[model samples]
Every structure is written in structure tokens, then in C-alpha cells.
Target: MFESLHQTQVIPDFDEDEVMLEDIEVEELHPTSTETEKNEWKKRKTRVRSDVWQEYTKVMVKEGDLPVERPKAKCNRCSRRIAADPNKHGTSPLWKYYTSCVKKHEANKSQTVLNSDESGSMINWKFNQDRYDCVKMYLTRKMHLRIFSVFPPAMCGTHLNLVVERGLEEIGMLVRRVREAVKWIMASPARSEAFKDTAKLYKVETSKFLCMDVPTRWNSTYLMLESALPYAPVMALFEIVNSAFVRDLKQKTHNKKSIGVPEELDWHEVRRKCGYLKKFHKLTEEVSATSYPTCHTFFKEMCSIFTVIRRMEGHEDEDIKRMSTRMKS
Candidate 1:
């Protein structure tokens, strides 16, 4: 047992003759300067490209940006050459232009939509949980007032519907043609200016600018017709001045369902329609007053509207009676 313990304590040694010495080469690990620079350049290019692409998408969604859909780097408005990395797809410049365009569009839209917000109730108001009930009460009353003024509870829903929507629907094709004519007139600034010049030549005084009616807003149609009625004689004068142009338009659109220039009868019909919609237009304006609460006047205003329609239903004019009958249905 003592010999076994001594043997365990002894260290095993290799014979010097079996051990051989040789030179072993060690490789140095140094980063390549050129490769590092290339990596940095790649990173910078990727970051710039990503930023540019973000800008491009924003511009694409904005209104009034030309080539808004899948636009290239060239600016549609300014016709300027956008800068981009030559080695890359060079799409960043275009994207940058697009982003700038969208920002401009948003700024314009905000200006138009919120022009009256400065005078609104919330102009200088602060919001807090402590005043939650007060705010709720204010909103509820304001909403109720607006609703009653626009649509009085005493008036039948169908009555409002018949005047606003059903009447327009009854004359579907005629409304469509009028809409098309207005669209054509307002298609370009040149066309609009020409129309105004024609009005001047005919010595016709137009009170308002030509307006395009919004299809969803029937009141807008009435407003459009009202603005257009006085210009009928001027349009006739324009047709005479540019008879060849009108003839060409007629020839080109003879086979196609194109929006044609208004004829004398079309103008007369527009005037007649405007006369028919005078009461509706007045009522719409009265009810849509935002600065003043109109609920108190809803009863009187609605009664007047009903009385006019009732009288029209038995009018001597065949067209007026027919229109009233359609509204009744």
C-alpha cells in the first residue's frame, strides 16, 4: 500500500530523444483598411437610400403632385433633375422630391379645411379630466342643436330625403349630363378663363365663379346651377365665336359618350332647374349656418318649404307640377 501511494505521487516524464523542436509560424490579424472603408460606404449608402425612399412614398400619397403614382426622380411640377447616388438605383432623389410634395399638399389642405377653426369654440380651450362632464354636456347640446337645425324632429325623414336626394335621383340622366358639362368647363384653367372672356364679350355680368357640384352634396348642385344660369347667354356667344371648335367636338364625340358643349336648350333647362331649386338652396344655407344656432328657425323654415312644394304640386306650369309630383313620390 505504501508502494502504490509512492507510484501515484511520481510524475510521468517523456524521454528527450522522442521530443523534437520545430518553428511554428503565427499569422497576424490586422483589419484591411480598404475593406473597412467599403463597409462604411455601404452602410452610409443604405441609410441614405432608406431615408430617400421614405420621402418618396409620402409625396406619392399627396394631392396635386404630378406623376403621383409610381413617379420617377424627375419633378413633375418644376422639371428639375433630382440628385441621387450613381452607383445605386438613384431612386432616393425622386423619393425626396415626393416627400417634399406631400408635405406641401398637407399644408394646403389644412389651410382650406380649418380656415374657420380660429373662430371655433375650441380655439383657446384646454382639456382636462376635471372638466370632462362639462365638456360632455357642451358637446351633447351643440350636437343636438346642429341636428335639429339641419333636420327638424317634427319634419318627416322622407320629406328631407325627397328634397335632398330623391329629387336628384328622379332626374338621374339630366343631372349626370349637367355634372359632365360642369366638369368639362372646369377641366382646365385655360377653359375657365376662355369662358370668362366669352362672358365679357357678350357683356354678361356673372355674379359668381363657375362651380363644380359635389355629387354627394345635392345643395352643391343647386349652387352650381345658380352660378351657371346667368352665363347661358355668354356660353351661346362663345359657341358662335368658336363654331369650328364646337363642330370638331361634336364630330369627335359623335360615336363616343363624351361630355359635349352645352346647347341653347341645355342652358335654358339649367336656368329652369336653378329657378326650381331656389327654395332648397335658401333652406340649405339657412340650416348650414355654423356661426349661429338655427334650431329655433327650423320650424318656420321647414313650413315655408312645405308650403312652396304644395303650391308647386298644382301649379299652372306643367314642368313645375311634374317636378313637385316627383318630389312627393
Candidate 2:
């Protein structure tokens, strides 16, 4: 009975609740670790796909050695194949097809000539007072020709002939007719009023008193002067003549109307206007010095000014006629 020394120890049971309640803090500083790993995997997959695609593209290019089929172009009218080269044909599809049509259109175009019913009127005559003065000087002084040479032969003879032919009084009737035309043209709403007025006035006075018709006689006079001078002097003389004519017309009109006021009436007015006059004079002087080039430049400027003025005044028909007349004369 004394041999059995058995020790009875109490077995401690482990509590799950106590273990769960224990503060077991996990230090997870990198919270996106799983997401980062997923992104790296995706990148690797993308790289492999890109490499495969590039290799496929290279293989395709090497095998083909040509581009895909291009769109075909054909002419609508002829139903023919049209070339794509712009230099050989034209840029637009329509342009290449319409080339022959355009040429045909141009070929079919007609020439138009302006017509006027007004009698005793010469076309393209301008009142260049300066030109008139120069022509007068050239005729009377340089060429030793009478003013009669500068003017058309006495319409007196023509009038007498017409009177005889038509049985009409020639003397005062012609003058009266011309004067009426002058007044009518002066009062006209046309841009040609200036030119017509000057021409009519010249016809009236010159024909009535001097038995001359300079307006109709300018071409002959110009030719005679041209024939007499060297080319350079001829051009200079022409400009001078033209300028004098314009100046004369202006002067005569002023004198006739008794508008004797000087352009610079007041001192202040002169000062204000001087700047423009100075500029004009400077340009004129420069042109005058240059001779032929100046003439060409002036003529070009004049045509441009005339064009603008015509457009503004709505006198395209009159302007065209006047320009053509000038060229012909």
C-alpha cells in the first residue's frame, strides 16, 4: 500500500476566447503589395504581346513588299480611267475632266464693242490742261506751226458741206448745238462729264472762233509731234502736252465761270493744303525726272484710279469705252 506514490496534477485547459482577445498587432506598412504584384504581372504580359505584334508586322511587311490597293478614279463624261498625278492632269478630279470644256468655253467667248449714239462726240478725249498748254507751245514755238495745225480743219467747210448737203443753216446752229451738248454733258450724272464737258467746250470755242476742232484732231497732232522728236523727248513732250491740256481746261473753266479765287485763299487754308500739294509736286517731279518709266508708272496708276472711280460712280460701260477710245486714239 505504501509503494504507489502517484502524483495527481491538475491539467490546465487552453481558452480560445483568451487567445483571440490577446492584442496580436500585425505591422503591415506595405498595404498594396498584392496590387503591385498584379500590375507587374500585367506589364510583363503587355510587353510580350507588343513584341509578338511588332514581329508579326515586320514579317508581313517583308513578305508583301507593296502597299494595299488604292481607290480608283474615273472621268464621269468619258467613262475613262483618270490619272492621279496632279502635274500631268490637275489637282481636282473635276478639273482634269473639265480641261477640254474650259478650253471650249474660252474659244466660244465673243468680243464685245461698246456703242454710243451721241454725234459729234469723239471717244477717249480727256481735258489735260497741261497737255494742251504744252501742245500749244510745241506747235506755236518749237514746231513753228499755227494753232490751225494743232486743230482739225475748219468744221466751217464741213458745216458748209453739210449745210449744202442737208440744206440746214451752218453758222450759228453748229455753235448752238455744241454749246447745248456742253451744258448737257456738264450737268450729266456721268463720270465722263468732266471729259465730255471739256471736249464740248473746246469744240464750241475752237470751232466757232478759231475754225478748229482739236478734240478730233489730237491723234494726227500726236503723230506729227512724235515723228519730229527723239524717243525720250517725244515721251517727255507727250506728258508735258497732256498735262498742259488738262491745266488749260481747268483754267479756262475757272476763268469762264469767274471762279477767280486762288486755290490757297486763306493763309491757314494754304498751310493745310500745302502738305498734299507738296507730296503731289514731289511725286510729279520724280516722275518727270524718270521720263519713260514715269510715264508708264503714271499711266498704270491712272488706269487703276480710273477703275476705282468708275466702280464708285457706277460707270463701267462708259469707263470701258473711254479706255478703249483712248487706246485707239
Candidate 3:
């Protein structure tokens, strides 16, 4: 048996602690020409835009906007081309320069007025800076800002206004109920305490009291609904506890106005309406931002609004569909 067995060296077994595993180096195989071509196409297909202009260009059409001159990028608002090559200008410098150009254009336009003669020839009537400044200063000193009230238009062919007004109309009953609930709680200290007690009873957290909404200000009404929704359960309980008070109040106002006490369904409606209106609310906030030019985004925003309205048209919820239809009108 020993002679038949092949001669072999005896291997000693090392302890587990003495054995160390070295990291294996991985080698990447060289890609074939076909794969390389495929990879190049994939990179092009999945290319991500890192610059603001690249992202903006997707939503912006070259039509209606000024075209950039060769070797430089032009701003849409001011039509100012970059002094240097846009590729080397980078993000910050390019955007800053463009905004500065817009401001400069705006300043020039403010001081410039057009005058026409009988022959229909036009001349640029420039205002004196000193005179303009003096007039502005005098107006600021003499005019009372409080007396000059600015009432924003409700419907001015804008999508924001369309949605907001329709949503408000749909939830008009719910709004009145919320307004009445707020009045009920605030009219008496006892009712207010009872309202807080009910919230405490239900272990509900409230950060603030219900806010009042101005009749003309729909934004404030949305805010009131937002604040009131959280305390809906508490308000419902308070209404039950003071049912007699509510009934007597209703009877007193029977001829003047109907103070409908909000029930569970009414509160739920308020919550739903708030959720529906939130999109318009957010749109308003975005468009009203003072930091950047919103006019450029008008077309994009209107498209988005129409898209939302179209989606809501087929919504499973009847209220949403109804609101969307009303907005369409």
C-alpha cells in the first residue's frame, strides 16, 4: 500500500488566528467596440442637466424668447448675451450676470417714455432722475399707505384665480360653518375653555387658536380652514355640549343670517376642501415669490394648472370632479 501510494509532502495545518486573507484585486475587462458604442449611446440618453439653463430650456421654447448669439448665451428677459463663452462662465457667474442685465434693462425702461409727433415719428422721452426721485419722495411723504387700499383681482384670466374661486364656491357652506364655529368659541370664555378641554380630553395637540378669515381674502380663508381642521373633533364635541347655546343663537339670527353649526360631515368637508385647494395655494405662493422673475414661468405654470385640472376632472371623488368642472367654467 505504501509503495502503491504516490509520494506526497506532508502539509501542516495552521491555527485559524494565524491565517490572514489578502484582498483580491479585481481587474475590469476591456470593453469591445460594440459595447463601447452602446455605452456611449446610453450615456447620451441618460445625460442629466446640472445647470439651471439646461433645466429651464426643457420647459422653455426657443420661440417667443430671444435666441442667443453664437459663442454666447442670451437671457430671455433682457436679451443680453454673455460677454464670455457660456460654457466657461459656470453657473453662478452666468446667472448673476444675466439677472444684473435684466435689472439694468428694467431701470432703463422705467426712465424711458415714448413720445409720438403728428407725423407718427417716435422719440425716446427720457425722464430726469433728479425730478423723478423728488416726485417719488414727495408722494411717499404725502400719501397715506393705509388710505390707498389694494384689492387684488379674484379672476384675471389666471389659473390660480380660476381654481381658488371655484374651490371656495364649492366649499362655501363648509367655510360658513367654520367661521361660525370660531365665533362660537370666541364669543364666550366658557365656550373657549370647553373647546380646549375637549381637545385635551381627546389628547389632541393644538399649536394655535382658530384664525378669522376676511370675506374678500380667499388665502386667509384657506389658512382658517387649515387651522380649524386640526381641532375639528374638539369643535364637534364642544358643539354637542353647548347644543342649547347654538340653537338659541340660531333662533336669534334666524331672520338675519343662518349660523349653521358644523357637524362631523361638515368638518370632513372642510378638511377635503382644504386638501383640494392646497395645490392652488402652493402655486400662488410660488408665483408670488419676489426673489426671481415669475413672468417667464407663466406659460409653464398655466400648462401645469391645466394638467392638474384635467386630472381632477376624472377624479373618483365627486367633490374633486365637481370643483374641477366649476374651475373649467
TM-score of each: 0.46, 0.14, 0.48
Error of 2 at 245 (Å): 22
Worst 10 residues of 3 by lDDT: 146-155
lDDT at 224, model 2: 24
For model 3, residues 1-329, the per-residue Cα lDDT tens digits are 88658778889986764443321222125556888899888887334345646312322223325764344445656565553333565556566765556344444435855558766678788879999888766655556432212212232335456557876787676787778768767778887787787788877776877778786767888888898888877766776777765775465342366756778888777777777677677778778788987877754655566678788889898887888888776
Regions more than 4 Å wrong, model 3: 1-159, 188-190, 252-259
lDDT of 2 at 48: 25
Q: Residues 1-329, candidate 2, lDDT per residue (tens digit)?
A: 45455656778998987776553323243446888899888887222222212111111112235764433344443444444433353335545455653222333237544455456444775699999899867765675533334233242223322222221111222222232223332343552344434445334322221122233332222222222212222222333434643243344432145221122122232233232223333344444463345655654433342344234345444433343333222
Among these predictions, the greatest TM-score belongs to 3
- As for TM-score, the candidate ahead, 1 or 2, is 1
lDDT of 3 at 64: 29
Residue 195 error for model 3, in Å?
1.9
Local accuracy by lDDT, each model? 0.63, 0.36, 0.66
